[model samples]
Target: MELFQNVVKLRGFLGRNADVPPSDGITEDAYTILHLATMSGTWDIATNDWKPRIDWHRIICPGPWFCGFTRGMRRGEYLEIEGELRDFEQDRTVVVVGKRYPAKHLSYTVHATRIQQLERPLLVVDTGDDG
Candidate 1:
């Protein structure tokens, strides 16, 4: 089976290099949606074992968290997002009410639990006891 290597913390720019859009994508199950393309590098710098690319993610923000993000997140701001990374296998065989089509691609997304900007976090998870 799988062992370890599932979480990631990235510091980068948005796909638009400014404003980030709302979370949007096809749901992975009943509770997750892949959203946003987080650009990790300027593409001008290349190193061995470094792949030139942009990382698309599904930063999980359940309920009010998401609403708050779109409202507070501004343009052209560099930030850090930390979360769990997972690869999901999707069946793209059906399109438009039962049309069958085959697709080839591996999907990897991040479920961000927190974001930081200039030593300040937008949201913090408080672990508490039920007692």
Candidate 2:
């Protein structure tokens, strides 16, 4: 029987963009990003305290998304990720399959179905003052 769920969502900063192995045409398409995340889960209820912890996960964007992510991200950029968690074979384990968007310095890899940059847009304000 399935004891629990394997769904997760995370928003965190990147450690660095490291190039991994096995490129599917594009060289940068095999890159991986180490994400640093912090999350708070539902309270214990009994203890009336929430589970707040810092998590680090290794997120790899394979194929197309790999190239897409590399093009859109910078060092320490904030990203939001949502996906299904699974287990990988080697090195990077605990793979997440979905979109939106790691940390760890852990053993999880998020195969993103979608990824978006959470960068703040710079707005130019017009004060009617001609420069």
CA lDDT of each prediction against the hidden true structure: 0.55, 0.59
Task: Tell me the tens digit of each residue's lDDT in model 2 across 1-131.
Answer: 78986666777776665444434556633555545454556778899876876667766565655564566455577777765665554432345676321322324566665556687436597787988
What C-alpha lDDT does candidate 1 achieve relative to the native structure? Answer: 0.55
TM-score of each: 0.47, 0.49
- Model 1 lDDT per residue over 65-127, tens place: 544454445444566777887778875654666776786557777777776665433656556
Clashes of each: 1, 12
Residue pairs whose backbone atoms clash in candidate 1: 18-76
Q: How does candidate 2 fare on TM-score?
A: 0.49
Q: Give the lDDT of residue 3 in candidate 1.
A: 83
